[model samples]
Target: MTCRIWGRISSINVRKVVFTAQLLDLTFERVDAGAAFGIVRTPQYQQRNPNSLVPLLEDGDFTLWESNVIVRYLCARHPERGLYPPELQARFDAERWMDWQQTTLNPAGREAFIQLIRTPAEQRNAQALAASVAATQPLLAMLDARLASRRFMAGDTLTMADIPIACEMHRWWGLPLEHAQHPNLRRWYDSIRSLPAASGALDVPLS
Candidate 1:
């Protein structure tokens, strides 16, 4: 059976999985399933992913959720691509960055995204958006510093670490707010954004 992914393209998490799948040249089908699409709350989707989240993956009889974990699983299946990173320390370093993207960076920027993109202008929360921008800016600076010395998140080559972070950056950059230019981060992001494989995922307009 062809691999199937459930999620809308507008979601950063879903984009990560889609970008990873594209990078690996994997044959898969992506279904629109969240937000206005409204399929996630269905009983069938809930059975496959109790969280009822976007970006659920089903390959044959196996099912998986959590975007980053799905990325890891897909990359692991295609070890020759080396996106999973074989070296012990390198693999862990990738894991740490991926975790940081989810736990730290995403939370900090989420409110800004919500207020600016999702919420109507009249209903937007200025204080919350300000706080979210403040929290996320420092993290972006840290990522800039991290990428200054390396071509990619884990090292010279694109790995699982780069997928989620790149998707996050794509979302951040798409926002209408003024942003301080982080040259190295921009450089890295541009390289990834320019990839043929990243066309659909990274190039999509922000909702």
Candidate 2:
């Protein structure tokens, strides 16, 4: 089945799906649809994804949205590839980190990213930036502790959990903030950075 992803290449959320597709060796087409491209708001695009968000995935007759959900679908459908573990407990453990990324880390990272990259220098809010950094530190520390014990977030094997968290980690580290030392996290990130998909998709500079 041919896969098409609608989103700009630079979006971290889009990057996660793109990386997952690449990891699975799935051939896909990507169309620029968000931000500067302005295609996401079109009527036809709205029909496919009413939210008009980037990273909408179309697999022949099947359509999916939300980057994390798309990744899960891709992994579950291709179980032998081992992207998503079959074990219920292990899968849930991996999923917990993915949820944490959405519920906790992304909000904090988005604040810092907007202030540092999107907002103009003259209008940037130092107070907001500081708050974002403070909110993100504890999460990074938690990841650090996890990485200290395991080679990957959920365990030694790389899983769906790594994709979203890695995307956010790239953005977090890209910002010009004084971050806490997380040696294990740094090491795990560096290891993933060497992977072909990560080197191509997750290594983009913060926008």
Candidate 3:
């Protein structure tokens, strides 16, 4: 069944779903309906997703939200992609990093993106921006340590975990912050940068 994915192209959350769909090579349609293109508040859209968030997925009659969950759903349709592992521990290993990106990485990482790119220089909060960058560094260090041997988040292969985290890294790296280098994280990112979906979506300027 063809899926209908809704979100603006520039949204990092939406990029996660887009990359997952492209990686799966699934038949789908993407509807622009968030941020400035505001269909998310429409009555019909709200009925489908009351949260009014971008990156909503509709597969036949099945609807899903939260970008990482949408990635999981799309991967389920094409098990051969190996992006979502079936084994319990392996699956959770992917899920764990996915959750950490949302709860830990994104929160800290978004600071510099917003302050430097979104906020005007005169209006920027220098202290909070610096603190946010500081908070995000050790988290990248954590992933660096994890990637010290493994080529990907879970193991040697790409999995659902890397989708959201990669978007987060793209945001962090794109900004002009004086970031502490995470060698292993940089190594993993360089390897994945060649993926068409990732190159097309995450390589864009931070917005």
Clash count in backbone of candidate 1: 0
The lDDT, on a scale of 0 to 1, for candidate 1 is 0.95
Write model 1 residue lDDT over 1-207, tens digit each, in one string. Answer: 589999999889999999999999999999999999999999999999989889999999999999999999999999998899999999999999999999999999999999999999999889999999999999999999999999999999999999999999999999999999999999999999999989999999999
- Residue-by-residue lDDT tens digits, candidate 2, 48-154: 99999989999998889998999999989888779898899999999998888999899977888999999999999999988988888888888999899899988
**Highest-scoring model, TM-score:** 1
lDDT of 3 by residue, 26-82 (tens): 788999989899999999999889999998999999888889888888887788888
Question: What TM-score does candidate 1 reach?
Answer: 0.98
Q: Where is model 2 more than 4 Å wrong at Cα? A: none
Ranking by TM-score: 1, 2, 3
Candidate 3 regions exceeding 4 Å error are none
Model 1 segments more than 4 A misplaced: none
Q: What lDDT score goes with residue 152 in model 2?
A: 95
Q: What TM-score quantifies how close candidate 3 is to the native fold?
A: 0.96
Each model's lDDT comes to 0.95, 0.89, 0.87
